[model samples]
Target: MSRPQGVGDGGQGHKAKHTVLALAVAALNFGIAQGFFAPLENHPSLLQARLGLEAAQAQLRATQSPVSLQAQGGVSFFEVTPPPGPPTCPNPLNPQCITLPSDGRQITLGLTFTPFPFGDVSDAVNQAAIGVEQAALGLRQARTQLEAQAVEAFLRVRLAERGLEVARLGVRLAQASLEAAKLRESRGAASPSEVRQAEASLRQAALQQADAERNLTLAKQGLADLVGPSSDPPPRLIVPSEGTPPQVRQAELQLANAQVAYDRAVRGVLPVVQGSYTRNTSDNDSLTLSLNSRTLQPSLSYTNQSQGRSAPQDRIVGTLQIGLSANIAFGVLDALEAAQKQVEAARQAVEAARRSSKQQEDLLRSALQTAEQGLANAQQARSDAERSLAEARERERLGLASPLATLQAELALAQAQLNLEQAELGRTQRILDLYRFYALPLSEVNR
Candidate 1:
């Protein structure tokens, strides 16, 4: 009779509406999940740490670069004229100063290079290498510190949220008590004072709720500042596994770097032997050789020279000669002594750092243990409070308890819940702190 038109249209509309609702619900759940599990990469502290690492890497590269080479070169031009009215030419074959050229010009080109020898370059290279290693350690420390900050902020936010929930629950219970008091007053079963007291409690509960909300906002802002801004909801806080603390690793790295620095300093005052060969070509050609002992302050040089211009009858000549020099500096002894003392100091520093790291680790372990015990006790208190609240509510419904008594029980339960949340948060934070000490990533908790 309906020609199936209404059945087809109506059925299609119902299916479409259901499909839209399902899609909306799925999207909401997905968004909640995403907010609850924000990745560490989004954290502002980690981003800053990454930037620091990049800077450190750049510094290391600069440090590792080769030293600048030392070089000098020049050209000189000059003219020679006969002195006074006399000719000083040795050749007598030509009279009237014909043997000497009236106008003569001379040009000279010279160059010198001081190569970077092994012994001479070792100190600088060693220092640069140590710098690179130190930079790497700095980057690691920054990352560890950033992760710890992010974890702490996340935990605070979770605590604030739970506190807000307890506050709201308290407000609800206070309102119920106020309504009961008013009814009892109307029946002359309770005095007007009870109603006034209930009203005051309600106001107090509202104030607490407002304070909790403000705390939650501040906590969320702190976390967002560290992780960067995000549209997604905040993730649940998870307790990271206990791992190697960053402080220990950082201390070890410092000790290693100090040792390297001390070794390099010692090498600075040590003996260095260097050799060089040089060649020069100008009006005359020459070869020069040199050796130096820096520790002894002794040096030797040899040179061979030949005249550039010559005639058959007047031949050019060649000559070779050797020279030596030496020096003594009292400052060298002082420098060497200072370096030795520095080495000793570095060794002591290493030992001190080791002891400090050990103590810190022990303290953190003890703290974590204490936090775990406290959390257990809070959980037990919370369970007891729940049972008490339930019994109070039952007695009130049975007319065996006053509305005020039931309200008091409810408040106690809320307080117990708040304490339990704090205990849980504290325990988790302590665990994360231990993990952070070991330089473990917060993301490891997900695993």
Candidate 2:
């Protein structure tokens, strides 16, 4: 009562494995373009960086403008009466009752400008410009980080999809094997224990299929969270040739800002020159110029009556004023020394960052090489498994192999194919890591 040696699925399961393999190979030939990452531009961190850049730009604009203008207007009501109860008019019937207007309106316009800024004002501008640069770099760094995340998510989805298909194929092969084992048991040539073993294998395959499905679902959800609800994953890895790592660029900018601070501390002790213009409705129109230093301030001003308001010639005058002031602090020298130290520290940080980046690049290159080797080995194993399965089928046809032997061969082939797919996915991941480390663009579709 022996079951036939060649008993399962005719070659359907084998063909399905081949189909998955072909799909995986096609994926390897297709490279994901940068357009795929465009959807991630709206990621929260990226949006934050963009906002920071805009703020920095506004600050820079404010710093570049040294002049300010202001306008103020108001209405006032007042009454005036002669002191002591006295009638100024001589006529008894018409006493000289002097009365003043009860209400008046006035407007004032003022303008102030720094003709030449000193004592850290110019330094303020330079610092603001540096801040703008830093913000721009930060935005670029955020984009690169988003690209890295997108690539990782993409890899997970691709691997999970392949795993789910492979698991399904495994289930099918297991079911076929179990059916052959049952036939043998019904023929009284196989024990109940053997049938139970086949059942156990089927259950294991089902469990694996369920796990694969869960993983794929989770991978898809994570990807959607990153890019959007609709994500079209790229077929394969995209690696750019070269780029400066964003961290190193950011550190260099920091060093520049530090250097600027040091320069400001050394050169910010010069005198300042300022000018102002003021217009008033009731009093005078004035133009003033001044020079100020830490120890002294000298100013010259000219005032004249308004065109529509009459005034004595004496009201128009020129005035010169000189004021002396001093402020001595214990930490002035210490502050300069501290700024110098910061510059040196920032320079050192830049060097350290460069060294660390280079080390990371070397490590990634080594890892990529290892991944390539692993992929080659997996492909070789799959080839061997295919040969073994073919041999097993030929033996069964010649009546030289048992049903159990053929089933094992088929299982080996399925596992080898799965391993090959996984290896391919791993190699793509290594390439992505290398590209991401360099802050290189992953896609050139739009470039």
Candidate 3:
């Protein structure tokens, strides 16, 4: 629903109202938006797709070398004539040898696109999903906190409003007392000392009224910050439903998400499947096939090399090769080790995050309990004050109590009523907190 036009700068004056519905809606919207943006930022497959072009810059160098094929045949029995090693032909697709095209040697095929493992991509997407989910939860929690704050602010404004009224009433009562004293003094029934006392009380009451007005002003401003300036009418504290709050059940979700992330990171050690084909001109042509099924690769290549660039005397040759290229030109072991360490570190971070979430739950629970107890105590005090006020009014009506006495009793009663109202508000806020921490439905609590 659209809100009424508010006061102040339309953009900068944005303020969320202190209402259960508003709070809940804000939280849900924030959560949904956060989740939607996850893939664009942190998802692995998404990131890989974005980074593909950058990696191409380096992969382009792969074409510079000619594909070489080496064939080794193991005979069950020693042969008088052993087949020569696979002729270094242009078989770039072959993982067995480094093809150097600049040496006017065999042309090797370009590196074939080996689709990244689904397992790893799935893990990344899952991790990102979890993070976005958690962020949304956090935003909801923040909204809840804001809701609680708005409720409290409203209560404060009410207290200040009532306080100001009481102060004004005190001033009036004091003036009445002074007038009575003056009348009695004129008839010689009241002494000068009594008149002085009445005058002092009036002055004191005026000061108190001023103080109360200032307090009220501050309270109104505080509420204004939350719900925007609703000069439409003063806001009131809503009686929130008596029940648990809505929260992200972070303690459990954290542990669950972390375990999943850790599992995914560990699973990344598996080699990705790879295959490629290449044909070159230095020799007639060559085709190499490679599959990354394990740490080591098992591959094959078929090549037909002419004596020169011509296809004349081009003999067909095929070689079966098993190549383990863990380390060759550059120290790729360091890179592999770094990747493994990165995965391991992520696993550790997940565990840490889970622990932190657990601690937060415990702390929030403690706060909720304490606030609830305080509210109960405040309510009891209010009931007693109300009874006292009733008795004082009855006595004043009967002329058994002085106006001063009755005025004091009324003042106390007003303060107590304000306190009770505040307590009720506080309890409602604490309940909202619980809902935020548990990720429970706001509807469940608000209803």
Candidate 4:
């Protein structure tokens, strides 16, 4: 006899539809994951870091072009009258001692500039460039930190999910034990106390399952918070690849930045030289040129003047002046000594940072090795527990062991599984932490 044609056709059709559905679901999931991680630069933390880098770059540019220019111009209306007493004029024929004109205007214009010199300005530019480098490093560090946090949160969710599964299994085992105990009591083979104990165990398991469910929900929410809102579920936890530690590099960067700061502080007390020019126009038009340094200043000025009571009687005079001056502030030597001390202090700090980084790297390496050993041990224990449980079940099937003994074996197996899962989670977490210390991107580390 052959199977009905309709029944065989229906089975094949159902399988084909199921396969198509699974493929569509898998494609959708792949697209979602690609979309989530594609725009890494646009992540909120990275965007903020990029802004900080841009600001530092702007400051560096400003320091590179440090020059000051100033211009002033104004118009003034003025009228002058002689005092009540006799006029005190240098020229007796000037205006014939008459009243001054009521309508007169004077225009004034001036321009001054100070160019950036080599001493302080150069130091500032160098410091700003260092700042830009620090900002870039800070951005990289922030990215590393954020990725580590995301992975940690994801792992926590995975751990919670595992815990919930174990809790559910525990409840099932407890209920089965309770049922077996009640059956034995009805058959007069088990005491009432045993039934009561079994009931208590089942209740405890139910409570544990509830707690596990609550924890799982909280974990899922935390994972959602880290990855932002999305319809897709959390991605599977991927173990990161081992890489070289970043502590040494981080220490080097700190030392370089400290050196830059120390150099800037030392330059702060050094001599400064500035060159300046000024042009002024008033009753007298003057042009001034000057060169100034820490100790000496030399200047020259040329002036052209026009003075009279009327336009035709105006007299024009031109004058030239030159001068030199010297200045010595005793405080600059004191400042130099203080800056030297600061440089020494910064040098010491660099050494301290280097030593600390070395210590941290060594400690993490040791911890990673320990965690791997622990995971291996847990896996072996789980294998033994599974084997024992299988033997206990076979013995019960042959009526050579009590139901309670088989249930105990199942409970042991469940505990072993839970321990193994926890050990695995711990190992994964430690590996990720090591990857983070190495400054490896979680996405690339997974690859």
Candidate 5:
């Protein structure tokens, strides 16, 4: 009785599964385009560099307005004090000058100077930092999701590959049984019905074999698509060397790191408030030189002009002045509020993402548990089949079993062996799953 080879060194299966899983993991890693790639791991401050650079350059390029001395052309006005003119004196020609009393007895002219306020270069820096952080955060979220997908794919390939070996063995054993029946029938010992039964069995085995083959083929194709450079499927069951889960802790670790990175990036979304105050003063040379607090008793201005065509007694006078000024604009508060709202929204998104990830972690843990149980059950079934085949062989040797009985025993044995193979396959698959759950690639686990 030729029984299919059921046991393996668990080496080849491990290697194959690990390789495929690794390829899948890498594919996901690259696809994310965010997580590992998006965050400025080495330089969180790099985001602020642009603002810093521009500010430095602007500062260097900044030109200060010279205290310009030029021919002033704008309307200039000022108050002057004249000598106490007799308010009650009604001199015929002086009536218009100072008929009634006035606070200031004279008039004077002065020029006002103002400077335009400019925007800070630092704001541009902050904006760029904000954008970089947002982009980095988005990419990170996508990357983490991809990592999970990769792990799942890797585990799937390993799972399918485990079932392939036994299924093929079943086909080989059935063929052997069918050949034996044909030989016995040709010698007129086996019944036609028996031969036909064997043939049918063989056909069923073949179908199952074909199915396994298809699954493996499809799995290979999937792996190839994920990894740019790949290898053809290796022959035989590939098993991990140590039979241990590889990189099983990586998943949680990666998620943790991602959380921290996202947190830092989020800070950029906060509203930045900026303000400054300045005091300045400038005036015409005459106004500056003549302005004084000295109280003119007469509260008036008088100018005596004895030059050019003016008569020697001709006089013109002006008064002194003092004052305060101010200006204000609205709407800065509204802009600040909008910026704060945007920050709040970004923070909320981060929280939502974290909660979702936690749930995914829980689901993965459940999948791992199921896979472990499946592997154990398959192993137990294989052991039972082996014992049944041994008993059948012994019964046949004693002539207590008919050819049909022996055939049944043989069939049982093949099925048992197939089950064993499946078990071994299942075991390896479970390990792969564990690796994936941890967010580690098959290569690390298999190795």
Candidate 6:
């Protein structure tokens, strides 16, 4: 009230605005979280992969169950006419001849189980089981890739924000420089050329601001495309100390599948054994057992039947049969050789994948070390800029330097700060690359 506090209200408002902006900037600098990728679960590609895995699992279950059941029902009608004279009345017959109409209905339900005593059934089941495992690994591979993409998108947004912050500071410094130059020109201390240079610098700063704004907008859009318009800051990504690369596991599964195939091919036309028990509504029950090879089959069956309800007499029958067969085809041998080759190829592929993975891990570690060095350089540059800015301000206060020089020093400090941020981003990116390469989960926030 002594000098009217309202006069300083504009300064207070500016301070408040700057404070809000600072907070906003701080909020933008958040780490990634496991929940950041929650929306990825519903992504179409991931959903499709999940469905594929489910289908593979269902196929496995079906292969494991060899039993089957069938139900059948039918109706039949018939009419019979007696011959006209009934064999010229050779036997005593009724004078009136009539047509007989008959209708029959039957319902049958049958249950059968066929078990392969040889390796055929086991081989098929194992193949199906392997398919399920492969599908599962495929899903994991897809998820890891998607998570890496999300991380990159998030980093892009953060980088854009940081760039924008630097651009804004640049604009402010340029504006201050332009004002100082105009004042000096009005006092005959600076020439018109200096004023024009200051104006050009301001325009350049404005251009940079525009570019940064555009970049930020694009980055935000890209991030929204993946996570669907997330306003909350992402949590920091935590790198795991150790983990297996997805490629290694995928290669291992492939090797397993190939080995199974090779084993089946090596079996080379084995014998088969089957047993079945079937019952139907026609009062018929049967058990059949068979053992067969490519060249011969021996079968035994037992049946119990009641022909009609009126008779109600049980009939029992047993039958044995032997069948001989021959196949001139020699494709089995060729298949065995091919399968052997495939097994060898898969083994080699596994080794190759492991080697490639190790190489990538080593490369990422080296890159991370390089990123650390870059960050250190940026920190040192920023320190030097800070000292220069302080000296410039002191000189300006002592009337030994122009205000524009002080502003230029401030701009340099801002640039150094931006470089430090970029270096940090680079380091984070290298770490993320390592994490993705290892297929490590990003949920470990403690680290």
Candidate topping TM-score = 6
The Cα RMSD in angstroms, rounded to one decimal, for candidate 3 relative to the true structure is 15.5
List the candidates ranked by TM-score, beginning with the highest. Answer: 6, 2, 4, 1, 3, 5
What are the lDDT scores of the predictions, listed in order? 0.64, 0.72, 0.58, 0.67, 0.47, 0.73
lDDT of 1: 0.64
Model 2 RMSD, rounded to 1 decimal: 12.9
Question: Mind giving the per-residue lDDT tens digits that candidate 1 earns over 151-176?
Answer: 56777877898888888988988898
Candidate 6 segments whose C-alpha is farther than 4 A from its true place:
1-32, 71-118, 273-316, 320-328, 394-402, 444-447
Tell me the spans in candidate 5 whose CA falls farther than 4 Å from its real position. Answer: 1-169, 172-198, 221-334, 393-447
- Tell me how many clashing residue pairs each candidate has: 10, 2, 24, 0, 35, 6
Candidates 3 and 6, the one with greater lDDT: 6
Between prediction 2 and prediction 3, which has the larger TM-score? Answer: 2
lDDT of 2 by residue, 142-206 (tens): 77677767767877887788788778877877888799889989999899999999899999999
Better of 4 and 5 by lDDT: 4
lDDT of 5 by residue, 97-187 (tens): 6433322222333332213212222233333444444444333333333333433444456656665665666676777778889999999
Residue 202 in candidate 2 has what lDDT?
A: 93
Positional deviation of 279 in candidate 6, in angstroms?
Answer: 9.7
Q: List the pairs of residues colliding in candidate 2.
A: 34-443, 89-96
Comparing 1 and 2 by TM-score, which wins? 2
Error of 5 at 240 (Å): 18
Check candidate 6 and list the clashing pairs.
31-234, 31-235, 31-236, 32-234, 32-235, 32-236
